[model samples]
Target chain A: MKKQIIYSLKSPYRENLDVIGFTFGSGEKSACIVGSTRGNEVQQMYICSQVVHALKKLERQGEITEGRSIMVVPCINYYSMNIGKRFWTMDNTDINRMFPGYEFGETTQRIADGVFRQVQGFKFGIQLASFYQSGDFLPHVKMMKTEFSQPEKMLEFGLPYALTRKPRPYDTTTLNYNWQIWETQAFSVYSYGTETVDEKASQVSVDAILRFLSAEGIVRANVKPGYVSRIIEENTMQQVHTEHGGIFKTLVKIGDTVYEGQVLGEVYNPLDGEKICEVKADKCGTVFFIYNKPLIMQNSVAYKIVDF
Target chain B: MIQTVAENELSVNEKLKIRKNTYQNGKGKRISIVTGTHGDELEGQFAVWLVGDYIKKNIGCLNGTVDIYPALNPLGIDSITRGIPGFDLDMNRVFPGFSEGTMAECVCNAIVEDIKGSEVCVDIHASNIYLRELPQIRISRDTAESLVPLAKMMNIDFVWVHESATVLRSTLAHSLNSIGTKTLVVELGVGMRINKDLGYQLLNGIINLLYELGMWSEKPDFEVRQPIVSFDGAVGFVNSDASGVFVSDVEFGSEVEKGDVIGRVLNPLTAESEPVKAVCSGLLFTLREYPVVYGGSLIARILSREEEN
Candidate 1:
C-alpha cells in the first residue's frame, strides 16, 4: 500500500491543503473511490478511511490482486472540513460541481482540475455521496442514467438498493456524471448520514466496497456476501412532505415498512407545541429516507418511501 | 398593475410568490426586466424599484407593456442567502425548469413560461459579496450577433461577449435565450448592498432599450454611453500570491498598463505587504469587494485590450 498526495494547494497563511490517495497493488488502475467533497460529510469520509484501512490490511496479507490497483481518496476538501464549512471556505463553491475542471479557472476549479486529472482514467469510480437535503438515506448504490451508465453493474456493490437517476442539467458538472461521460463506470454510494457518523452504516459501506472489490478481482479477500440489491428508479420513490413547518416528531425510522395513511411524523407548532399536521404515508412502502432535522419546513420532504 | 408570475406554497402557511409590475399604454412590443434571482445580490433590488417607479411616474412615456419582475427568489432575498433558503439550491442554476420537478424547478419553469415571449428581456444581477463588478452586459458568443446590438443600447460600461463554453446552460439567461427570447444579462455592483448610481444607470439603459425596441413613445433626456464591446478580448485574471487583507491601490473600472500595482496583500502580524500587479493593460471590470485574500483568491479580472486590437 502506498500513500500518495494526489493534489496540493499552497496556502499563504495556513497549512497547505492536500488531497491524499491511498493506493493498493500496482499496474492497471482498476477502481477509485472518493469521499466527502463537502466539509460536513463526516460519515462519507469515515467510510473511505475504513476502506483504506481494509485495503491496507488486504494488501499486507497479499489479498490484493497482482497487476491491479485501487485508489481510495478518503476526503478531498479537508481544508473546509477543518473549519467545519460545507463548501470551499474561501468562495463557498462546491468542488463536486466543478468536475472536468479548467486549469486556469478559479480556486475551486483548479483544485477540481488537479484532482480530476489524477482520478479520471480509472476503470470504475465510486463516490460516497451526501444528499443535498439534510436527511438519512437507506444505504444504497446510485448511478446516473447516462448513455455510458450501466445500471446492472451497481448490483455488484450488494447494497440494499441500487438507484438510477436521470441526469439533470446541474448534474452534468458533477464528478460522478463527468466520470461516466469520460467512460468510467461511476457509482454514488449513499450511506446513512453526512455530518454524523453512523457506525452500523459505516461498517455496511466498508463491507460493501470490499465485497465489490473481491467480486471484481481487484482484491482476493473473503467477505460476507451482502444483499441482492433491488434496482429502483430514483424518481419512482414516493416523497412524503410535511404540510406545516414546525418542530418535527418522526414516528418511524428509516427502513421501516410503512402502510398507506399511516402517520409517519407530526409537525408541532414550535411556540405552543400544538400538533399542526400529521405527515401520513400516501403509499404502502419501505421508508427509504427520513428527515433527521428537528425543524421541518412546510412542503419539505420528510420521508421518502420505496413502494413494495 | 401588479401581477403574480409564479406562486408556490411554503411550509409555514406562507407563499413563495414572484410578482411583476406592468406598465402599458397601448398595444405594442413587450419588454421584460428581471432581477433578484440571487437573494444576496441587492443591486438589482434598487434597479427594479427605480425602473418600476419611473414607469409608474412616466406612464405617458410608455407605449407598450413594460413588465418588471423583481425578486425571482424572494425567499433567498428575504433570508439574505445566495440560493433558496431551505433547499440550499442556487435559483439561477435551475432554469428552463421541469414542471414536475422540485419546488425550485417548478418556480423556475413558471418564471420561464411567463417571460418566454417578450420582445426583449434584461436580467439584472450583482456579483457575489467577495467581488465587485462594473456595469456590464454578459452575452454568450452564440447569441452575440442578435443580443450585442440590444446590449449596446443598455448603457453598460462593458458588453462582454463570453465564450459559450463558459456560460452555464442552466442559467436563466441561457435558458431563456435557448427558447428564442432575446434575454440580456446585466451584472454590476457588489452583493448585499444597493448601488443607486449603477441602478439608475441600468434604468436609463432600460429606458433607452424601450425606445430602441419601439416600446417607448418619448425619447429620454439622458444620453447613453456607447459601451466597449469585448468580442475577442481575453480576460486577464489576477490572483493573490499571499494571504492577507487586500488594500487596493487603483480604482475599479480604470484602465491600467501591464505590471501596474492593483493592490497589496498585507500581513499585519509580520507587517509585510506583497504587491499584486496587472498581467495586461486593460479595463479593470472586476475587483475584489471583500478584502480577505488567500494564496489563490481572485483579486481582479481585467478585460484585455491587446486581444481586441
Candidate 2:
C-alpha cells in the first residue's frame, strides 16, 4: 500500500472552464495518471465513479504512509464536463491537444504547463482513461522515433496489444505523446475505445495499473490480467487507403488477425445503390486496426494491419 | 443614448439605426419577424431581407405593421457559430431571458420585451445544410394548437408539431410561450448558404401566414395545403462512421424509398467511394456538403417513418 502527495496545484482555468486534478502517492518518486481525459455521458458520471474508487483503495490498506506520489486528474475541461462534451465547449478545442503545456497563456495552456511540470518529476506510468462516445478507437501506445526509452517500458503494463508506432507530429498536446521528450522509462498506455461505457474496458485499464505498480516493485499483489497478450509478432503497421469515395462497412474488428486479399470492408454508392469497392486487406497478417464504423470519405484510414 | 456593450459592440454613433416603417390599413396588426438565431444559417435572413425590400417599395400597401430583426446573432453570423459570443449559449434558447445572466440572456430578455403583445412571432432558420430541408413550420404541438391552423396558411409542405421540450433548450418559441405569446418557427435551406428556391418559397408562405392572421388584406394567391407529413413522424437522423471528405448523391427536397443511396463516403487519394443508404422512406431533407466526420456523426435525416408511427 502506498499513499503520497506528489504535488498540490490549482488549474489556472478554474474560474474559466477546466479539468480538476487530485493527486495520490508521495515524495521524490512518482507516476501520473490522466484518469479521465475525454468525458461525455451523464455529467460527472466518471468523476463520481473515480471518487468512489479512490475512497475504496485508500481504505483497503494501512500502507497509507508512502514515499512516492501519484497524480490523478479526474476531470479535465470543466466546461465540457458541465455540458457532457469532450472538447472545450468555449472554443470547441480538445484539451488533450494542449499538453506538456504553455507557461504564459489561456486556461488550457496554463493547465497544461502546470500538469506537465508536476508529472515531469515522477517515475511511473501515464495512463489516459477515455470512453469513445462517437467512433471506435483501439487502445495502443504511440512514440516518436526518437523516443527509444518509453515504448520498451510500456510492455510491463501487460496490455492485450502494444502498438509501437510513431506519434503524429501534429499531436503536440496529448499527455501520452508528450512523453517522447524524455525517451527512457517514459511511455504511454492507451486502451480500447467504444461509444458508451464499456465497464470491461475500465476494469481492464484499472487492472493494468495495479499490475503496473506491482511490476515496478511498488505493490506486492499478484494479479492475473484477463487480456494479457504480448505484441511479439509484428513490429511495423501501415494505414490502408481506399481508391475512391464511398461508404465503408467493415468485416473485421480491431486487433484481429488478417491476411492480404481478405475482405477488410465494403464500399458502395448511396444514391444509385452501387457497390463501388471491395476493400480488401492489403499486405496483412493481422488487422491491427480497421475503421470502427462506416460513412467513410476519400483517403480516410480504413484499416491499419501489419504482418509478423 | 449612447451605451457601450462588449468589445465587439459598435460605438452608438457607429451603429446604423434601422428606421421602423409604420403602416395602417382599415384595420391593424403588429408583428415582428426574427431570423438567424444560429449565426451561419442565412436563408431565413435572406428571405426577410427580400420581404423587407418588398415592404419598403410598397410601404403604403400594408394592411398592418411589421418589424424585422434580420440577424439576431450577428456575432454568430460573423464567426459561423451556432450560438452567441462570450458564452456557450444559443440565442434562440434563452427565450424570455434572465436579467442577471450572460449577454445572450440580456439580449433575449430585450427581444421578449419588444415582441410583447405582438399578433404573431415568426422565428426563421436554416437547416445544417448537410441535408436539404423542405420549407416547414414547426408548431408546438401539445399546447400550441392555436397556432397550427394559421401555420397551414403558410402553404409549406410540412408542419412539424414538435413539443416545446422536444426542441433544444433556450429557443425563441420556448421563451415566447412562457411569456404567454403565440409563436411559430420556420426552417429552410442549410446553414451558411442561400437556397434561392427555398428562400422564395418561405417568403411567400410567411406572407400568407400574415394574411391568414388578419395582419394584411392581401389574399394568398395559392391555396394552402397541409403537408402529407406530421411532426412526430417526421424526424429521424442517420449518422456516418469513417471520417473523411463527405460526398452525397441525393438532392435536397427529393423523395426516396428505404435502402436508397442518398450519399457516399470516398477515399480522396485513391479515388475510392463508400455509399450511404437510407434506412427508411421519406423526404431527403438535407445532406452534409463538407467532408470530415467522426463515427456516428450525423450524415442525414429522414422525415417520419412508418415504423415511427
Question: In TM-score terms, which candidate is top?
Answer: 1
Per-residue C-alpha lDDT of model 2 across residues A71-125, encoded as one tens digit per residue: 5655554456566666654335455657776654433555566666656656654
List model 1 lDDT by residue over B198-275, tens digit each.
Answer: 989998999999988887878878889888888645788998867788999999889999999999999877898999
lDDT of candidate 1 vs native? 0.88
lDDT of each: 0.88, 0.59
lDDT of candidate 1 over A1-308, digit per residue (tens): 88989998866567888899988899999999999899999999999999998898898899989999999999999998999888888878899989888776777888889999989999999999999988887899999998888899888889999999998777888899989988999999999888889999999999888888888999987778899998999999998877767889999988899999999999988777789999999989999999888987666788999976
In angstroms, how far off is A175's CA in candidate 2? 24
Work out how many backbone clashes candidate 2 has.
56
TM-score of every prediction relative to native: 0.93, 0.52
Q: Give the Cα error of residue A235 in candidate 1, in Å.
A: 2.3
The prediction achieving the highest lDDT against the true structure is 1
